[model samples]
Structures are given as C-alpha cells and as structure tokens.
Target: MVAVVTALVLLVFIASFRFYARFLGRRIFADEEPGFVTPAHELEDGRDFVPTKRPVLFGHHFTSIAGAAPIIGPCVAAYWGWLPALVWVVLGTVFMGAVHDYGALVVSVREKGRSIADVAAKVVSGRVRLMFLCFIMVLSWLVLAVFAMAIAGLFMAVPTSVLPVNIAIVVALVIGWLLYVKKLPPLLPSLVALVVLYVFVWVGTKVPLDLADTGLDKDQVNLTWILALFAYSAVASLLPVWLLLQPRDYVNSHQLVVGLGLLFLGIFVAHPSFDAPAVRMSGDDAPSMFPFLFVTIACGAISGFHGLVASGTTSKQLDKLEDARMIGYGSMLGEGALALASTMAAVAGIGLVGFCALPGQGPVEDLSWAVYYDNWAHASGNKAAAFVLGGGAFLQQLGISAVLAQTLMAVLVISFASTTLDTATRIERFIIAEIGDALKVKALQNPYVATMIAVLPAIVLATMRVADGDGGVREAAWALWPVFGASNQMIASLTLLVLALYFWQRRRPVLPLVIPMVFVMGVTMFSLVLHLLAFWAEENWLLLGLTVVLSSLILWMSAESLGLFVRLLRERRAAREA
Candidate 1:
C-alpha cells in the first residue's frame, strides 16, 4: 500500500507540472511575451533583486515555503486518517495551492515585485492594503510562534539532531561565501556542503546537545530553545539575501531532496502496511474532520504563507515572467510531496513496538498507531517526533542503524523548519518595514528596528504559559498552532480573493481562481468560527483573543473585496447597456 500510494502521487505530480502548469503559464497568465523583463532586471539591486536562474530560485522558494508546516500538518492531520490527509494534499495542491501561488507571483510581478499586500491597495482599496499588511504581519507573527515551537519540540525529542542542525548553518555560511563572494560554480560547493552536513549528523549523535542537561525542566528548555532560535532569526533576517538566507536555503534544498528520496526508497524497500484506519471520523476528543482537516493540512495543500513567500521574496528575484509557473507552482508540488511523505510516515506501522510516553501518560508498553494517536492532544503535540521516529524506521529497513536513521530523519525535519524560520522572519521584517513607511514611522522603517519588532512578540507568545487541562500549566508555543492554522487558511483564502478580484477586474475567465477561492474561504471561515466558540468554551483566552482579532480582519477585508467585486460587475453591466 505504501509503495502503491507513493507511486500514484508521484505520477499525479508529474502530470500536473507537465500539462496543468503549462496551461496556466501560457493561457491563464497569458505570457505571450517570452522576452518580457522582470523586477529582478528592472530593479537590479545586488541584495534583493538579483536576476536568479530558474533552478536556483526554485531551490530558495521551495525550501522557504516548504517549512515545517507541510511535514507537521499532514502528519498531525492523520489523527483523522491518512486517506483524508493524502487526498487533500494531492488534490488541493494541484488545483488550489499551486494556482494560488502561480497567480500571486504573476500579479506581484506585474506590480513591480511589491508584495501581494502592497498590490492589494490597487486590487481592492488603500484601506485594504493596510489591512492586508497587518493581516500578513499577524500571520507571520503566528508563523514564527508555530515553527519555533515545532523546532524546539523536535530538538527536545530528537536530541541527536541538535548538533548537526546547528552546524548546518555554518555549512550554509561557507556555501554562501563560495557562491556569492568567491564566485564559484554552485553545484560543486553545494554537493560538498551537503556531504559535510550529514557527516556532522554522525558526530551529532556522539555529542548531542540536550537542553534538559542545563538544569531546566522540559518546558523551560523549550522556552530556552525558542529564545535562541529567535536570536538566530533576527540575524538571518537582517543579513543580505545572498550571504546566508539564499545559500543556506540552497544547501537545505538539496538536503531536503536527498532526505525525501531516501525516505521513499526505504518505504518501498520495507513496504510497510498501514497501521491506522483509512477513515477515522469519530472520536470524542477529535475536532470535526471537515474543516479541521483543511486547516490542519494548509501548507502542503494551499497555504497563505506560500503566497507570502511568493510575493514577499520570490517575486523580487524572478528573472522573467515565464519562470513564475515553475518557481511558484512547481515548488508547491514539492511541498505537497513532502506532506505526502509525512502522512505516510505517520500511518505506516514499520516500527510498531517502540515505547514512548504521551502527555499525562506513562510509556505505552506496545506502541502502535492506536497508542501514538490515542487522542488528539498527543497526536498533534508530538508530531515532529512521530515523523522522525516513523521515518527513521523506514530508513532502518535500508540498513541504516537505528540511531543514525533517526538522526538522519531528525536532520531532515530540523533542516526543513530552519529554512522556513529564516525566510518567514525575513519576510516579517519586510512587512514591518513596509508598514513603517506607510505610517511614516522612521524607527519602524529601519531594518534593524523592524527585525527586532518582528522577533519580540513571537518570543513572548512562544514562551507564554497557558493553563492546560488537568489543573496544570504548559508552554503555549505549540498551543498557538490552532489559531495559526486558521489564520494561515484565512490568509490563503484572502489571497485567492485578491487573485479572483484581479482576474474579474481584467474581465478574464475567473472560474479557475474563483472555485478554490470560495472553497478555501468557506473552509477557513468555518474553522475559525468553530475554533472561536471552542476557545471561548475552554476559556482559552489567548487563543480566543487571537481568533477574534484575525477573524475580524478576514471578515473586514472580505467585505471590502466583495464590495469591489460587486461594483465591478455593475460597471460592466452599465457599459454594456450604454
């Protein structure tokens, strides 16, 4: 079943890229002028607007948006079943997610590489531009919390991954120096850096850096790591793109592909059967799979964050109009594949008997799908560990040692999360600076100041203590995920709205954009409403507060966009009558 499912997904991805993506680039976007110049050429700054080749830019874009969410979302969503998660990932990416990305890239490029938020000023209204910026900033804020929490938890669970993950930064730094400063061909240096990174994976096991050893309890240790991770994000954001961010992502891009290849190969070799049921719709503790599944698996399917990475950074370096299809649409396909692998990792029963303790429970003597996913909280909470351990078991079938296979999988997870962490923080810095210029706040316009503002709020959120069930307190990092996912889907839906409005104004065929727009918007709204009520019921004031603020933004901007859409229709009717 594992091999069959994996092969089927690969086939679908290939067909979509070859046919569907080509149709979008040529027909919908209508890129007749193959020689059309892009922002990378028009505003050729060495720092942000470098006219990058398709392959290199694809690497940057893929790794940036492919972050921990794709891996974690699908695996966690498997709390319901792999069938729902897999179907959403495969179908959603092809129709909605890829199109959303491709459209955002095209529109932002047409608007001279300004972010989609900035572009929203023209698409809807100036008021909407500000609203969109704030919405994106807040989403980026939640994003920082979610990914930081994920990385911190993974580090705690997979202590052997700690050392290699840090050293990957140093390795990336060297790769950047070689490519940008020393002017070397990228392939050789990138391959060497990747090799160096895995060698450190072995070394990491021998010298694992466990934060618990530093006299802090588990929660304290998680907070400590979040703080440290934010510090790194600050620096990564402020640094020039070519120096650390781009080259680091390049290394990780290769690292991700290699890791994923080995994982699937192992799955084929082991041919593990599914341990979890296909359709799991009922559990007293489970949220409704209808909307929850969509939000839970946002990134690999359709993510607003992908649009952010699309317009926020990727569009700036787009070398030409035609490249948008591959960079924008193709990368989402890559993430979908990542998400698919994560789902398989969660469902396969390759290592069925290992014992691991869940929250509020001792180690289960006979670990399996039932034990690992005994409830919603544990399934979602330990998502990274589930992927690492599950993927490691797959690799062990390929003759890798238990420790090494687990460490390798850990390296894969950390590498994915870290690249996204770098990109998201940089994007948030960009948003803060843009907001500063709009508001005429000189301090906020400063990059250093913007980076600080970007990092701090998330630090507070990631470190906050929330009252958990059973009269105990817990770190609020991962707890932010529910709000984060809802906010994520909301943004995706809004991006679709922006795209739908863009096409409607131009009087182009808007069905392709409208269908997904409506579906994702409905899903986002449904999830947010349900979450608001549940949060209020549980007295989860933090989550409730966040849901209220974000829901308001979604509703407000949606109203504004709808008004514009209606007005545009009236204008068309009047013109026809005249």
Candidate 2:
C-alpha cells in the first residue's frame, strides 16, 4: 500500500510538472519561435557542437546532471524523514530546478551557447562574470573531487562492481564507433551494448576483485584508485564527444532508467512499509530542517550544476528551440524521480537491515529510528553504506541474490559518478580555457593544457586528509560535502539571478524567476552561515576559509546584479515613455 501510494504521488507530480514546463516554455521563454537558428546548426563541429537528436541530447544532459549526488543526498537527507525529502524533491523540481535549468538553456541559446558565467558578463558586469567564473571553477573542483572519491570508494567497497564498470567503458567505445564511424543505428546497438553490460555484471558477481587483497595498505589502495580514476578522466575529457562522452552517457542513462524501473517494480511487488520515522528531530547540536534540509538535499531537488550543464553543453546541441523544455525541464524532473526512489529505498529498505552504529560510536544493543538518524548525521560514509544496503534490499525483493543485488546497486552508483566526473572535467576544461581567454593567457587556451589545469586541483583535494572519527584519517571528500551543498545551491541562486536579468532585459515578467531566486538565496545563505560557524568551532580553517570565500562571492555578485537590474528596468521604462 505504501509503495502504491508513493508511485501514484510521484507519477502525478511528474505529469503535472511536464505540463507546467510546457506552459512556462510557451509563455515565459517563448521557446516556440519558428526556425530560430540553434548553436548546433550555426556552429556544427564534429567535436562539441554537432546537432544531436532529442533523445541523445536528453540522455547526455540527464546522465551528466543526474549523478551520484541525487542518490547520495536524498539517501542521507532521509534522516529527517522520507516525507520531507519527498516533498522537497517534487516541489523543488517542479518550481525551482526545472525553471533554473530551462531558463539557463534559453539564455545560453540566445547568447550563442555560452555558459551562464559568460552570459553574466553581458547581462551583469565584467566583474560579475569573473566572480561567476571563479564560482563555477570552485564548484567544478568540488564536484570532481567528491565524485572521483565516491567512485573509488564504491570500487573498493563493492569490488564486484569494478569489472562491470570497466567493461561498460569498453562497450561505450564500441557503441561510439558504431554510431559515429560506421553510421549504425543507435537503438539496436545500444540495446546490444546494454545486454553485454549486464552479462559483465553477472560475471563480476562471480569473481569480485578487491584492491586491498593485492598486498596494498588501505591508504595505498585509496591513493591508487584515485590516481587511476583521474587518469581515466584526463583521457576521457580530451576525447571527442561522439567518441566517448556522448555514447558513455547514453549507456549510463539507460542503466538509470532500468534501475529505477526495477526499484519501483520491486517496491510494488514487495509492498515494503515505511519503517523509518516520518520525521525525526535530533538534539540541539544537530542542524535544523529549515535551511539545512534544503542544502543537504541539494541535487535531489535543485542543483546549480544543472544550470552549468544546460548552458555549457545542452544548449549547443539542441535540435529545436522547443526541445529546450523537454531536455532541460524534463531532465530535472527525471532527477527528482531518482531522488524520490532513493528516499523510498533509504526509509523502507534500510529498516530491513537494522541501523548500525556510526564510526567511533560503539555497537548498539538495539537500533532505533533516532539512533539511525543520529548515526547517519554524524558519519557521512555510513549514510552511503546504508543507501547501498537499502537499494540492495529493494533488488532482493525481486528474488535476486543478496550479493548480486548489492553489486548491481554499487555498479549503478559508480557508473553515475564516473560519467559525472569525466563530463565535469570536460566542462571545467572549457571553463579554464574561457578563464584564460578572459585573462588574456594564450597558452591556457589549448584544451590539453586547460584540462590538466582543471584536473590537478581536484587530484590534490581528493588526496587531502581530514581526521576520521576513529582517530585515524580519511580523504577530504566526505568532510567537504557540506561545503559542496552550500556552494551548489549558491550556484543555483546565481543562475536564477542571471535568468531574471535576462527576462528583465527582454521586458518579460520576472516574477517566475525572481520568486525562486529569493527563496534559494535565503536558504543557501542561511545554511552557509551555519556551516561557517560549525567549521570555526571545530577549528577547521580550510573549510572555514572556503565558506567565507563562497559567501563573499555570492554577496558581491548578487549586489552587482541587483543594482544593474534596477538601472536596466528604469532605463527601459524611460525608453518606453520616449
């Protein structure tokens, strides 16, 4: 009954959002302009600007944006309750995330496919552009660092996932060759490739490969996997989109759809009741639900990163103006659906395997809802492990073996993270090049040099250490996650501001853009302040400095944009009177 109700609610929200997106596209963006030249057509290059079919472009955009964050965030945020997470996922996607993504795409298309930061230069000021670019660079660094570590962790934690993940890459290369070089039809070949991927999944379960078994210590294993993943990113980032990026994402997109379908189906068949509390409040030390929930569940509901992908890549490949609504707005709703599934799994499935004690916390005699939430809130890695276990439980409901189900779930997570890491690297490469051009540095314009510049910081950060709860140390990824959430939502707010400015310049009603902008700004800023205080108390100077810098940039950019928007509005009024 719970599963049926959840499914119905999600379906209704998704259907309604689709219709609303159409209305916004038609009325707000006027996206139906006939024969408007798209950047793909105007600047068709074999590399990045090639005109793409709607399905292919949507796959690329969705997979790139719908990475491990959506799954990871909601899984952790379910600590507050499934109800809150679900509500935010649905409403945020419909009202905030979709609008941010759609508007960014429209603005970028109008600006010949430049990034939102680039668009900021013309709409806001040159200083705003520089700040926005710096903001994006930092955001990308966090994304790359977090996701690369995530994939490495998954590979180590679920060793059976390694072979399948590697095999999928090889299969993507084959599919890319068929689709681009041989001009083979995509559907049949993609279907075959998916089948091959699953075959590897089954084989991997039979022969799991653990890196620690190869005579390396824990630290050495972590370092090795991190280095291996970034190496893969470097090469993958440099390759042509048709060769690896597009086809690989296309494959992963299918995997996501299939995974979601199975999850929902298993829920319906198993009829798992919600065991976690509908809402839980921890002690005074815990973060409150107001702004923290919004920031904590950042990507599941709304992500500023979606705006980057929309403007950075998707706009350039749009086949038609109308497709912007489908690709941009639609992908966000798709991500919301993923977030919804993750929340359901965490609340319901995790109950099947009673909650365990968090790191540095001794084993409990019995696990309760309060203990579960408390443990997860304290140990980020525990939340990730809990999600994997919960997702595996969902798969087991379909009569799959427990080991196989867990491996499959890990594979799904790794695949999502890998795609995001490589795509972000490529996007960062472009950003680095753009920054170089802004600074008038000729050497940094080369893609290879730019890509190296983009990846090095992430490598350095991922390998950095923070004190582990067990009196040891762990990679900085988990420690950096809170900052990532604040930064991510801040990016979304800045994007909304840019879109609002776009509407204002064109004399369109700015209410749609402005409302979400104000709400997100409030939520993100509040959370940032809380994080700043927390980091200060803990004497974590690095994250403390990051929080301060990000807060300052957001304030600076917002002030400049607001002043310019008012002047623009007044000038427009004066011109109309004349």
Candidate 3:
C-alpha cells in the first residue's frame, strides 16, 4: 500500500510539472522575453546579486524556502489523517503553491528583482507596498525567532546532530571556495561534499556532544544555542552569495535529494500499512479539517514564505529569464515531494518501520501506526521527531544502523531550518532596506545596518525568558507559530493578487492565478477568524490582538486590490465601446 500510494503521488507531481506547468507558462505568464538580461547580471554586486547557473540557484532557492515547515506541517497535519494531508500537499503544490511561487519569481525578475512587497508599489500603490512591507517584517520576525528556538531545541534532543551540522557548515565554506575562487565545476565538488557529509553523519553517532553536560539546564542551553545561531546567521546574511549562502544551500539541496530518496525507497521496501485513518474528519479533540487543514499543511502545498524567498533572493540570481518557470515551479514540487514522504512516514512508513509506541502501548502486537497517532495531542507532540523515527526505521530496513539513520534525519531537519534561518535573515535585510527607503531613513538602507536590525530583535525574541508551564521561563516567540501559518498563506494569496493584477492589466488570461488566489484568500480569512476565537477563549490577548491587526491589514489590502481591478475593468469596457 505504501509503495503504490507513493508511486501514485510521485506521478501526480511529475505529470503536474510536465503538463500543468507548461500550460501555465504559455497561457498565463507568456511575457517571457528570450534575450532579456536579469538583475543578477544588470546589477551584479558580487555580494547579493551575482548571476548563477540554474541548478545551483535551484538548490539555493529550494533549501532556503523549505526549512522544516514542509516536514513539520504535514507530519502534524496527520492529526486529521494522512489522506487529507497527502491530498492537500500534492494538489496544493501543483495548482496553487507552484503557481504562487512561479508567479512571484517571474514578476520580481521583470521588476528588477525587487521583492514582491516592493513590486506592490508598481502593481498597485505605494501605500499598499508599505502595508505589504509591514506584513513581511512581522512574518520575518516570527520566522527568525521561531526557527532559532526550533534548531536550538533540536540540538539538545539530538546531540549527535551537533557535530555533522557544524561540519556541513565548514564543508560548505570549502565548497564555496572551490566553486567561486578556484573556478571548479559544481557537480563533482557538491557530490563529494554530500559523501563527506554522510561520513560525518556516521562520525556524529560516535561522538555526540551533549550541551547538558556543561552544567546548564535545558532552558539555559537552549538560550545559549539560540544566541549563537543568530550570530552565525547574521554573519551569513552579510556575506557574499558565493561565499556561504549559495554553495551551502546547493549542498543542502543535494542532502535533501538523498534524504528524500531514502524515505521513498524505504516505503517501497517496507510496504507499510496505515495505522492511522484514511480520512479522520473529526475527533472530540481534533480541530475541524475544513480551514485549519489548509493552514496546518501550509508550506508543502502553498506558502507565503515561498513567494518571499522567490522575490527576495532567487529573483536576483536568475541566469536567464526562462529559468523562472523551472526554478520557481520546480522547487515547489521538490518541497511537495518532501511533504509527501513525511506524510507517508507519519502514517504507513512509521507503522511498517516501527515507532517508540505510546506510553502504555509499547512494542506489542497491537503496535500499529495508530499507536503513534492514536491521539491528536500525541501526533502534535513532536512533529520532526516522528518523521525521523519512521524515516529512520525505513533506513534501518536498508541495513543502515539505527543510530546513523536517526542522526542523518536529525541533521536534515537542522540543516533545513538553518538554511531558512539565514535566508530569512537576508530577506528581512532586504525588507528593512525597503522599509528604510519608505521611511526615508538613509541609515537603515545600509545592508550592514539592515542585517543587524533584522537579527538582533529576533535573537531577543528567541532567547527572552517568559513564563513556561507551571512556573519556569522559556522563549515566548515560539507562541507565534499558530498565527504564522495563516499569515504566511495570506502572503501567498496577496502575492497572487499582485500577479493577477499584473496579468489583468496587460489583457492576459488570469483565471489560472485568480482561482488559486481566491481559494487561498478565502481559506486564509476563514482560518484567521478561527485563530482569533481560539486565542480569545484561551485569553491569549497578545496573539489575539496580533491576529486582529493582521486581519484588518489584509482586509484593507484586499479592498485596495479590488478597487484597482474595478477601475481596470471599467477602462477596458470603455475601450471596447470606443
């Protein structure tokens, strides 16, 4: 069952990319200028805007945007059932998510590589751009703060990951030197780095470095790691694209391929059964599947964050304008592929490979997939760890050692998050510079100043002590996740709105973009209302207030977009009559 289902989902992705994507390219976004130079060449600075080959840029783009969300989102969303998670991820990435990402990349490339937020000034109005920038800033702030905490926590849980992850960084630096300075070919160096990466993955198992032994409590160690991670990301965000970000992400992309291949290959061999339900629509404990599922399984299907990454960094590195379709659409499919494997791991793969069963369930004959997902709370408890356990189990089927498999999975999670952390910081830097230009603050426009401003507050958010359950202190920024999903989707919908207007103004077919835009926007608005109610009932006024503000801004922007479309239609009608 696992093998067949996996093959079917893979087919959907392949077919969608082959047929659906081509239809989109020719019908909707037909403005591709064959000989046009991109901003990567027009504005090459050796730092942020150097032209890059498509394969290399695709790696950078994919890793930066993927992070752990694609894995975490689907794994957690399995609460409803693997069926809904799988269906949404596959369908969403194909129709809505890939379109959202591809549209933003193409639009940004045409607009001189300005972020979608900045491009808003051209598509709609300057004030709308301001509103968009504010949204970008808040989302970025939450991403940095939340991801730092996640990586720190992972480091504590999987101490074996500490060494290999760090080693990958050094390897990335070396690979960067080889690629850019030495002018070496990319394929051999990257392939070699991947092999070296796995070697250290094995070594990490033998030399696990636990921070708890250093005489600090869990919270203290977590905070220390968070601070250190921010410092590293700050430097990473400021470095030239060739030095660290690009080459490292390229390597991480390869890591993702190997990691994914393992999971799928495991599903094929193990052929696990579904211990979880096919369509778990309701439980007394689970949230309704209608709107929440859309947000819960957000990143793999359609994500606002992907649009940010596309316009923010990837747009500046296109070696050719044609690469947008492949990089933009292809990368989203890559993410969907990851999400699919994770869903299988949570459901059938884990059931076949085996998991550390629930507290009382243990390793009994009844230890099916349901033992791990019998309750919504259990499924939600440890998202990435669940994937690692199941995926690790799958690896074990291939004769890999349990310790090595788990360490490899842990390293993949940490690497995905780290790439996103630095990339988000860089995007935030761009946002800050754009914000500075808006406010006419010349100082904030400086890249150094912008990056500093971006990382510091995030560090404080991630490391700041707040009341933990029962009385201990912890970072409060992790609280932002509930709203982050909805807001991120909102970003995607609005990006589509911008694209819709871009096409509508030029007398092109917009139904393709509009369909997804409307659906995403509708679900996003619905999900935000539910989030607001939950926060209100829980008396989480901070989040409630934030949701209200975010909702109001989205509504205002929606209205603004509507007015622009209304005027455009009127003008078109008048021209038709004339």
Candidate 4:
C-alpha cells in the first residue's frame, strides 16, 4: 500500500514535468541558439534522417524501448508484492530513469549519433570507453541467451503459435519494404497487412498441431537456431535502413503501441483485484532490496540499455536536435508509463478465478519451487483462458475471428522475444567489436568482423544452456538475472557519475546528479553483495563464477570513474591557478 501510493505520487509528478519542462525551458531560452547540432543535420541522409511525424516517431521509439523485461520482471516480482515493484518502477523512473534515458538520447544526438563508447573516448579516457563497450557486450550476450530461452519456453507452452508469428513477421517485412524501399505510402498497405495478419491469427488458431508426440514438446534451446538468429543480426544491422531493422522495428512499433494501448484499456475495464500483498517481503529479502531493486526494474524504470537505442538507433534517425528532448526524454517517460501499466497488471490482473486455479492455497506458497506441474498448468491455463476471452472482445471488433485472435495474441508475444533476440545480438556484436579493437585484434577492427566476434559468444552461451536440459531456459535466466541486474544498475551508476562529473566541471548545480549517483551506487553494491552471499550459501558454482566476473567488471569501471574524477579535479585546480 505504501509502495502503491508512492508509485502513484511519482507518476503524477513526472507526468506533469514531462508535459511542461520543454515548453518552459524553450520560453526561458528563446534568445539562445541551439546548444548542439546532431550528425544527422550536419550530414543528412533521407534514409535514416527522414522527417517522421512526432506520433510515428514516438511509436517507434516506444516499441524499441519496450521489451519482455517490463512484463517478466513485473510478473515474477508479483510473487513477492506488486507494491514494491510498482513503487520502485514509479519513483525510480521519475528521479533516475527519465534523466538517464533522455540524457543519453540528447547527448548522442548532439554528438552526431556516436555511441556511448565513442562518447567515453571523447569525454573520458580510452580505457573508460573500452570498459563501457565490454560491459555492454556482455550485457547483450546475456540478454540474447535469456530471451532465446524465453521464446523457446513460450513455444513449448503452445507450439502452434510459433508458425503464425513467423508468418506474421514475413508479412510485416513485405509491408515495410513496399512502404519504405519502394517509396510508397505506408498507411493503406500497413492497414491491409495488419488486417490480413489478424485473419491469419484466427485461422491459425483453428489449425491444430498434433501434441501426440509429447516428447517433442520439451523446449531444447537449439543452438543452431540461436546462432542463425545472431548470424541474421550481424547481416541485418549492417544493412541499409530501408531493409531489415527499420522495417521490422516500424511494424513492431505500431503493433506495440496498439497492443499496449489495448492492454491498458483492458486493465482499466477489468480493474481486477490484487491478490498479492501490498508489501510482501522476500524470505532472504536480499534480492528485492536496494541494489537488486534498481537492477530488477531496469528498463521499466531507468536502464542503461536505452542509451544503446538512443545512440545506436534513434539519434541516427533524428531530423533535428531540437526534437532530442521529446524523443529522448519523452520516450523515457513513455517507457515509464508502460512500466506503470505493467505494474498495474501485476497488481490488478489477478482475480479469484486465477487464485483458485493455483496449486497452493496462499500467494506466497503458491509461488514456491515446490509448486507442482499440475498446479502450474492449471493456473497458466486459467490465466490464459481469461486473457483469451478478454482479448476476444477487442479482436471481434477488429474483425478477427476467435481462433485468429488467440493466434494474434500469441504472435505479439513471440515477436517481442524475436525482436529482443535480434536487437540483443546486434548490441552484443558491437560490444565485442569494441573489445576486439581495444585488444588490437585485426578481425574486430572492421565493424562487420567485430559483429561476428560478438555473435559467437551469444550463440555459444544459448547453445550450452539448451544442453543443460529441463528448466534450461529458466536456469539460464536465473544465472543472468543477477549479473543483468548488477550491470544494468552499474550502467545507471555510470550515467549518473558522468552527469555529475560534467555538471561539476561546468560549475553548475550538481545536486541532481549527486543524489542519484549515491542512491544508485548503494543499490548496485547492495545487490552485488546479496548475489555473492546467495551463491556462497547455495554453493552454486555457476552463479559464484558469474558474480566474480561481474564484481571484477564493476570494480574496473569504478576505478576508471575515480581516475576521471581525480584528473578533472586537478585540471580545475590548474585552471584556477592560471
């Protein structure tokens, strides 16, 4: 209840600031010239820099920013208490997340779409740049492996949905090509494609796949498929905007907006009661504490991952730096809103029907590992059934048949995983490429070559997990979660540190950066200790190994920042002397 109230209060505060900040800032600085010129403006290419409508751009940015984590974290954390999840997401977003995301975008645009790695190289030291890249690369590989397993799990649950989603993707690609590459208007074709895709969802649902061969039902992370996916990303990211990434993202963005909108609508309409406690604490309580909370609610609140999107993707497409605040900051707020909506789902999506369907009598015990398969299946079935019926109402109005609606819903879910996979692979490849360059590897000097280096790690990691058998995906996810949370928070910490450093050097107000910097560092450090302690207690060697690696990386990064701080201080002292 406290968390819920806190979340609501912060949400209101951010929403107001997001609306009026730019207007006020613009009015106050009307006489001043633009602070920076984006690379897009200096070297405009219609391909990436084509002026898109604000709403359309918002849709794209929002979709790229929203991913499976928002949904999964909330769902998993719901087992603990929706109140903590909701409060953290809201408060964190307003204070830290929005600033990080918006700042990353604005900074990247001003720097001409150069990535954070490049930013570090220019603003800090080469070592710092290398650290940023290496950290991100590792992050990407973990993300890809985890998402691949997630997709596999979803496929195993309802194998019939996979083909429909794959088919929908192909159809989406065709629509994108015609619209962007062919220079045709996208409105009609996209609409038609969506309608047809919805139809496929309905028909595909009726076309049943035989589950008689239950042995095939088990999800084995096919390394080959994952590698193929990475291989595709290597080629895709290298391709022109008129091709893969742009088109896929465009379609995905539109679908995401619609899906999220409908979901929000459904939430408001159903207004289901919350079954979980407002502030239930974890047994060890370590995982949900300060440091872990920051990491656990990464994207839904503030994520370093968004910097990749802002610099790597969105900045390249900005027609004007003037729009940076809107695209960068506004997009973050939008993401925050999505996270809030997810929190609402976690809090209010459950009903008596869902509770009764569970294996155990109570919420806490129901979420335990001891929960049986029958209970899981029953709950999953009940929840899925309710969603299907609820989703049908909208689908029917959209002219989607009952079966098609289910297929469509499944397609959206699959696409989320697929897009996350491809995007994660590309990001990882970039990270490896940077590391290779740092190590003076000849192959990684070339972007294409570096991407290949990056792809291999993800492929190998995903494959190995698949080989581990039952709950391989789940196991892989658990292994990555702590590291992912830590690295994510570390990135947030770095961003705040950088902002603080920049502001301090400029002799401006440093409170904003200083406050967040200290808070996030506390969060990251706390989470790291918890993870290490858990590993020690359980004697989980894999986790222990992961914690060790992550701790080393964090220390290395911290050292880089401290050195930067000392260098800056000395420079300021010298400036005052002069």
Cα RMSD to native, each candidate?
A: 1.7, 2.2, 2.2, 5.3
Q: Give the TM-score of candidate 1.
A: 0.96
Q: Measured by TM-score, how close is model 2 to the native structure? A: 0.95
TM-score per prediction, in order, is: 0.96, 0.95, 0.96, 0.82
Expressed as tens digits, the lDDT of each residue in 11-74 for candidate 2 is: 8667866688877887789899998999989998888887887887888899999888998888
Among all candidates shown, the one with the greatest lDDT: 3
Compose the digit string of candidate 1's lDDT tens values, residues 285-344. Answer: 888898899988989899999999989888888887888888888999999889888888
Worst 10 residues of 4 by lDDT: 365-374
What's the lDDT for all of these models?
A: 0.85, 0.83, 0.86, 0.60
The better candidate by TM-score, 1 or 4, is 1
Candidate 4 off by > 4 Å: 1-14, 17-37, 41-57, 185-188, 208-228, 284-288, 352-409, 465-474, 503-510, 566-578
Q: Write the per-residue lDDT of candidate 3 for residues 1-578, one digit (tens) a residue.
A: 77898899899989988998888888877636778989999999999899999999999999988888898888888878778888899889999999999989988988899999888889899989999998888889889998888789789888999999998889999999999999999999999999999888888999999989989998789878988899999999999988999999999999988998987887788777776888887677777888989998888899999999999999999989888888999999999998998888777666655335332234544335566667766666566766787788888888888888888888988888999999999999999999999999999999999999899888877866644333454356756676889999999999999999998887789998999999999998998998888878866666778889889889988899889989998999999999
Of 1 and 4, the candidate ranking higher by lDDT: 1
lDDT of 1: 0.85
- Candidate 1 shows a clash count of 0
Q: What lDDT is obtained when candidate 2 is compared to the true structure?
A: 0.83
